[model samples]
Target chain A: MTTTPLSPTQRTTIGRGRNRMVEDRAELHRLLDDALIAHLGVVVGGHPVVLPVAFAVDLDGPDEDGTLYVHGSVAAGWLRGAADTTVCVTVTELDGLVAARSAFHHSMNYRSAVVIGTARIVEDPVERRHALGLTVDHMIPGRDATLREPTRKELAATAVLAVPLHEASMKARAEGPVDDAEDIEAGVWGGVIPVGRVFGAVVPDADATGPVPADVVRRARAR
Target chain B: MTTTPLSPTQRTTIGRGRNRMVEDRAELHRLLDDALIAHLGVVVGGHPVVLPVAFAVDLDGPDEDGTLYVHGSVAAGWLRGAADTTVCVTVTELDGLVAARSAFHHSMNYRSAVVIGTARIVEDPVERRHALGLTVDHMIPGRDATLREPTRKELAATAVLAVPLHEASMKARAEGPVDDAEDIEAGVWGGVIPVGRVFGAVVPDADATGPVPADVVRRARAR
Candidate 1:
């Protein structure tokens, strides 16, 4: 099925650097899939507070529109204030560091997705459970199946919010650093050094029932 | 040298979760140094905007306080709007994904530094150049010495802002996921899968005049 792209508004539009915009809906999904965490921006008391939270995107809807899921503690109260207000959720994957010979041209090669939407608080008990399960499964496939679902008391302590992925945009810079003519003639080492995340040594918990599960072992290699 | 810790307003205070608070100045510097990118929060036109930007922290000041430098193009005007406004610059390093048997207990092991301060535009050309040098060298050491300095025209096109580290605080969670009593008894595989960044194969520029320099080669290994 063909997916409609996210329509951009004045804030979502990349007016300054147009070349970095990624308009494809599928590409946005790919970028969000790889992101381990997302920065949720909310205006509190006339100031902006950006906090990192474990996030997941639900893509099973008919429009192929993405639904961003984020959760925090009731005590933290970050999501509580976010209800009904406009919020910006951004995910960035730093692909590499661009080392241009000219200091002015030095840059980073990264893929970022910016989504602006209203934060709809998940108040319904049924929807809350779904969002929580999606977060666990999104981070690690087969995780939700293995683990027990959230209990009523556990769900009461958690707060989840959803943002429609309709008004979103992805911006990426993947090419090598472009050094100017004079700097190239000066003979500096100019290139792109790829930067990426991978799995480090696993630390099993005290309650681990067996060796690392096969799902985790496979996920490690892919991560 | 001992640095005076940041005085917190009601908003910056970690009253809800005081256990995650880090008060040491030296530890905050180390957290900022390890961040791949920082999310800069600014309130513009009654809305909050969080954008990822390359950033550096200079801890060589006499007071042993860090000065954060974040640069953007004059055209984008992000850093421009930040002048004289309260801004929040946050750097997060995701250490691992904490997998708990219960969905509610799933968490992320991360170290995040949040600096809330008023931005001061770098008007002095001398200080501007120094901050830019520190940024480039901090990301990739020894490259600034080789590359040509920014010309006046180039310098004019860039805007850099400085936020003192005095009001900054670090919040980190570095333990295994906390599974509840019932789920721990359920005997699901619950543990922590460490996550971190590394360098992929280097891609040299097409016009390279010599082999990749020793610094870049060394940088790749440590990346």
Candidate 2:
């Protein structure tokens, strides 16, 4: 893990709840690795549009800090609009639901990382293939090696966009409810309800298939 | 359960995967209700910014259709930038991870709702209180009723923004992996690993007295 501190640009700086901001680069990487998807924001027709997309991060990438890769169909309008333009990608993992004595203090315990930078449409075929493999492996470790290589036609239909992780910032809340002293004295129940993603039993498709692979089983249980 | 079809304005129209768009208003409402958090996108300094926030929806509240309420501290810069301006709010639930024989066909089964409209800062005291209560109970059902009423000072420190749901659209993909016939003939494993949110046992804070409430237990199990 790199000991480099996350350099938050002016836009990426956390304005509110400064106490929640984390400057550790490793922490940002951990948050991004744990998250399954990211919300990508781009301006379309003078309006900001945000959509969820599966993403994977490359720590030793060619970008300033690293590269965050997100893919979509070439026909996707948002991807086309985001090309060579500034965008914001956010990944959040809600750890728990904090139940406070007062409604105002109710909050969610979460770790979120926001990356702001220009999105470049990757043109190099070699890098595109590498990013695709990273994306697949990031979702299911070791599963990428088992899959067949993408055909030329399949590559033609996909669009991969890379955003530099130079201006990333992470914020997290991991504590119990912070309630007023008066409310605590009032004897109201207050605590945290832990929340996490659970992977259920894998169901094979109707098509002919062999036994589920060890990698898939491990991924299911690892969660 | 309004029978009204989701009116997709010119901008709300799904451009890439039109078949995935759902026109039923009830489907949009259901997607919003099932999601605990939303990624709110707003343009700041000519760049798009996206952040996750806890949100609640009102099915019959004032607006062309209904209202989506998100609360934050009054000092939040994003809340101030979003006020009286067009913003995009997206709620996405990743249902399952679609694992295919080929990495090209690998995808995720998800339900997502996107709402784009002007955000009006809530001013009316009664409406603000109602929205605050909804935000609280939406996180943990029956939670607001158990907690004491918010003090005047607490309400003054909060900022609630409402976005109308008139321009909302929902999209969902809920099927097994769609793979090429050749991959199936290759005898490769392909299926969907179901994913969902799991809530763990509620841990009471040190200051908390008395037994955990029944509502909290029910909420934990209901998840």
True-vs-predicted CA distance for residue A67, candidate 1, Å: 1.4
- DockQ of candidate 2 (2 decimals): 0.88
lDDT of 2 by residue, A1-223 (tens): 2445664577777888988989988888888888889999999999999999988888888887889999888999899889999999999999999988899999999999889999999888888888888888888888889999999888888789999988888899999999899889889889999999999999889894678888888888877
- Could you list the iRMS of every candidate? 1.3, 0.8
User: Which of the CAPRI classes, incorrect, acceptable, medium or high, describes model 2?
Assistant: high
The digit string of per-residue lDDT tens for model 2 on B117-173 reads: 999999887888899999998999888998888888888888899998888888899
The number of clashing residue pairs in each candidate reads 0, 0
How many residue pairs clash in model 1? 0
**Each model's C-alpha lDDT?**
0.81, 0.88
In model 2, where do residues sit more than 4 Å from their true spots?
A1-4, B1-3
Instruction: Give one digit per residue, the lDDT tens place, for model 1 in A1-223.
Output: 3456654577777767888888888899889888889998898887788888888777862223757888888777778889999898989999998878888898999999888888888888887788888888777777777766567888898888888888788889999988778778877778988999988877889878878876666666776
lDDT tens digits, residue span B1-223, model 1? 4477643556777756688888776677777777768999887667778899888777763223667888888787777888988898889999888877777888888888888888888888887888888778777877788776789998888788888776777788999878767677777778888898999878998887788877678778884
- Chain B TM-score, candidates in order: 0.93, 0.96
Return the TM-score for chain B, candidate 2: 0.96
